[model samples]
Target: MGKISYYTEEGLNRLKAELTDLKTKGRAEIARQIAEARDKGDLSENAEYDAAKDAQGLHELKISKLEEVLANARVLDESTIDASQVSVLSKVKIKNKKNGAEVSYTLVSEEEADLKAGRISVGSPIGKGLLGKRVGDVAEIKVPAGVMEFEVVEIAR
Candidate 1:
């Protein structure tokens, strides 16, 4: 069963754009490569042909996977998301208990998860621990190192 993916309006648009690029532009590029390989020589012992076929297979697989994800995607209403507590689409501020360091992250869909952009996937360790938490609440997350505590400083939509 395909899991439903929740996404913001911009996120959904980005996914759609990616799907289009993969299906059209990507297909054209791979087809060109395949044709070039085919023109090289006899197919019976063509390593280039084999490599092209493999690459095409990979490209098709990626397209299929993205299509499946798009089929099950559900756009989230950002306005409906509560800023009172940490949840999907919520920007959460947390203070690391051990280091006294503070970090802010926005919980978003896996597709939109970018650490450099401060967006984390809901399934991530820190994200999971932060979910459903409110301001001033502490979440004890278990990592490979050990259990680390974090205090929820704020939450925003």
Candidate 2:
């Protein structure tokens, strides 16, 4: 119903591919599983059939959600992005105000957030606080642990 905002072109394509997979490959797999289970025994008391039906329901739910995402997805243009401030799709380098430890994070969409890969969702607490911040600005972001402050060291495209 609402827009599915994305940070990069690649991320949008990935979502589309996932949607296609769910519609095609995923559907085929579920159908096969259901058919196999159906062949096992009587429908009323068949545990395998019940389990397969449940799996089908869950798979359909995923497909529905994926379709919604694909319908609303808007891919961001990389060339038009301004690097003067911390914004979505920007690679931001920040320094901890208290500890002075520096780290770099690529701001992305919620679906693309991978902490291990240093990609953070723009809607996240830290990312929300960092948005629109220019170099030398301090972003006071609240986390589950406590409030942490990060100084914007650099913003890159």
Candidate 3:
């Protein structure tokens, strides 16, 4: 079994929709391509047929992976989240100890992470370091550059 991952209701719904689309429209498109290629005749010498077959294999693999991900997904109720400490779905404000810069990010599952929107994955280095930490606690995180220190300024749901 795959490891279980928690997601917000919206995130889980989005994932389910994507899986449904892949299983329906995606598979239909691939099947259509294969049918068109086969109509060319002489499958042994048709490069289009070979390419279509390869594409179908890749498409099925993607569907399988998506199914596995859905199987292990667990939706978490946002109302139950505690704001007293850093955790998934918590919007946390932190100050960089080195440069005195401040930024806020919402900790989310890997599937919901969008850095441009200030959403980060709890599996990330900084997120992991901040997990379970309360305001006024310092988190030391190791990144590709080096170890950086950040002080938790606030946590909110």
Top lDDT prediction, candidate number:
3
Ranking by TM-score: 3, 1, 2
lDDT of 3 by residue, 14-54 (tens): 99999999999999999999999999999999999999999
Best candidate (score: TM-score)? 3
Q: Model 1, range 68-144, lDDT digits (tens) per residue?
A: 99999999887887778898999898999999999999899999999999999999999899888999999999888
Candidate 2 vs candidate 3: the TM-score winner is 3
Question: Could you tell me how far off, in angstroms, the CA of residue 75 lies in candidate 2 after the best superposition?
Answer: 0.8
lDDT (0-100) at residue 130 of candidate 3? 93
Task: Report model 2's TM-score to 2 decimal places.
Answer: 0.95
Q: Model 2: per-residue lDDT, tens digit, 38-136?
A: 898789999988988899999999989888877787888877778788789999999999899999999999999999999999999999999999999
Candidate 1 at 94: error in angstroms?
A: 0.4
Q: How far in Å is the alpha carbon of 103 misplaced in model 3?
A: 0.5
Clash number for candidate 1: 0
Model 1 residue pairs with clashes: none
Ranking by lDDT: 3, 1, 2
